[model samples]
Target: MTGKSRAPNLMVFGVLLCLGLLFLVLPAYHAGNLARIMVLAVYAMGYNLLFGYTGLLSLGHAMFFAAGMYGLGLSMTGWGLSPVPAFAVGVGAATLASAIIGFLALRTRGVAFMIVTLMFAQAGYLVILYFGAYTRGDEGFVIQQADRMIAGIDLSGDAARYFTAFILFAVCFLGLAWLVRAPFGRTLIAIRENEERAQMLGYDTTMYKLRAMIVSGAISGAAGAGYALLFGYVGATFATVQYSIFPLLWVLLGGAGTLIGPLVGVFFMFYLIDISSAVTSAYMLIAGLALVLLTLFAPQGFAGELRKRVFAWLP
Candidate 1:
């Protein structure tokens, strides 16, 4: 095709994508599903920042996620704070908590680091589970005011919440994209490629790792806040091993190193689960099999494979 023809095609594609997004955000689409997908995408993106960009694998991301949820839950219920400020407080709390955890975990490498993080997350989960009074144990906290107005906008309406989430997702993704292109991001890549060499070159690998963890945690926390608002509840289930593993699956299945890959993976996995749940009582089994097949057959993920095909077609 001529360059002129290609330009129009590209414009049409962009317009279609925007329209599709608008359709997804429509109130008739069901707020629960949209919010679930958006929050999960945000969570997956946070995990991708560390695993994809920094080459650090974490198996305890649920800890940060839970931290955010509980932070928002407690603030709103306990202190009667508004949702927006509560979310901000939750993000700060989660970031600080992750920073401390990352500080200790960064001292180790490889599987040890993964284990330490997992253990920490599990410990957190157990604490919430056992503390029935504070966390309401397994009963969970019902968000009675999830529909409350913030900045003169009611969150109870599906359209409003969907747009709010979409805006937040776009902002976070753009900020992350900018961050990965900055000098600090380059340093992170350097550390990921060769920590020892980076250290020898006078780079502070620990600080870099901690900073990455903080950013990842903060973003994940915000996602958690969104999750709570959408679901109108917070439960111990949010802090499960499954939650942590899901993000890893998203990163791996979407093409870990690419920004769009995780988002693509989120859509694929969520839809897969949605379909599987409709077909069988054992949704986990179906989802697990799908993940295994994707990992084995498409190691570079859907986005990576698509990129290869596109390049081949171009040539």
Candidate 2:
């Protein structure tokens, strides 16, 4: 590949290599934290695809995440399906939910779209509660270690879980980086920049947006499914409004519309909380102040600012 074409591949490989090395060098506790961060980063990347790239802000992504989590959780707990099939069912559930939500929500734009999505998510949460007997509701249910295996590998183990998360994050990270450089990805960007103009140019903006939403939701769901399988827990908290807001925070803090931004943001936020909580009971206050400072000085986020000033080829 030419230098320009090779840049993204090299960058992705470097990141994966760094993560692999860290797994070997870091202490067990931190290694586990990094694994969780990687999974959460996958979720943030999904959010970035729609918000950062397509300019479609959502407030109900937790529903898609929950859809995948519960899909896997219930399929295994209720139906006795194996982890592998249950994982597919979980992702498929999120995909279907996104397709349905996108079909309806894309009909509106701006704040209206956000409201519609939030409403749908709220409904999903309520439905999960209504079927508390099956779901175990807000208290949630746990998957035993036996059910957390795939192809004879136990995901419940620390190393297996960590590497599984690593693989999931790497695949999604590389896939999205490549996608954003493709023609379809560029078309979404064009629509994000000027939907009317894209429509004038004879492109189907709605269709493109719908497709973006489905892709975004699918990735988010995968993260959720992975979390349930690896972590061995499925709970209502993952479906709450706070969960929906998390990816937005991660994307904005790292840098919107940039490939590495999600991972950077996830890592920063995770450590910020980790270190702060150790120092004082009012960790959130410190986090809030830090975020305010970042907003004032680095509005485009850490990676966004870095891309702007230093590595123009970042992505």
Candidate 3:
């Protein structure tokens, strides 16, 4: 094909893809669930920065995720703040919490670090659970219809909310892409490969690890904000230990080392869960078994394997 003809074809394809996505989202679009998936994807991306890129295993990321959600929920419900400001507050709280946690967690390495993070997260969960009156604890927080005005546009409609979330996801995704390609990212990879060697080269490994933690936590908080806005509710279940593991699974399932892998993993898992639930009541068992099979047979995950097969056939 000529270059000029190819350009037009690509443009048409892009437009078609966008239209298709819009159509799919429009009909089955539950504001709450869409928000949940988007935010969960964001949350998983943050974990990917640590586990996928940095090779850091954290078992307590849900602490920050919950913190962000509850922080937004409390601000909007208790203080009558707007979604934007409330979300910012939630991000701040999660960031600060992560900073403190990172400081302590960074002191250890490897499995010890994972254990420390898990313990901290569990402690956070208990704290939220015990304060039932303040947090509504197990009952969760109900979101009320609050005015969401952005540049003269009232974002009360489901479509508006979905678009808002898509915008946020795009921004975060782009930002992460840039971050992973930066010099700092190279240093993180080095640390992941050999911390002792990175330290010998004067790369303050601890500082890099802590920085990653903060970035991951902040992004997770941003995701939580999206969740709160989408669902108009927040609760303890959001921060459970299981939520933390899912992101790890997503990264691994999608080919962790690559940038687009987590997204591929999310889409695959979402559809898999949707289809499996429709087929049987024992969806969880099936999902678990699928994960086991994926892990056992496709260690590099589906994306990595697909890429290899496609490239092999091309040449």
Best by TM-score: 2
- For model 2, residues 179-257, the per-residue Cα lDDT tens digits are 9999999999999999999999999999999999999999999999999998999999999998998899899999999
- For model 2, the stretches where C-alpha displacement exceeds 4 angstroms are none
lDDT score, candidate 2:
0.93
Q: Which regions of candidate 1 deviate over 4 angstroms? A: 1-20, 24-27, 30-32, 308-315
Reference-based lDDT, each prediction: 0.81, 0.93, 0.78
Report clashes for each candidate as comma-separated counts.
0, 0, 0
Clashes of 1: 0
Clashing pairs in 1: none
Worst 10 residues of 1 by lDDT: 7-16
Could you give candidate 3's per-residue lDDT for residues 51-75 as a string of tens digits?
Answer: 8778999999999989899888888
At residue 291, what lDDT does model 1 achieve?
77
Measured with C-alpha atoms, the lDDT of residue 269 in candidate 3 is 79
What's the lDDT for residue 196 in model 2? Answer: 95
lDDT of 2 at 254: 98
TM-score of each: 0.89, 0.97, 0.87
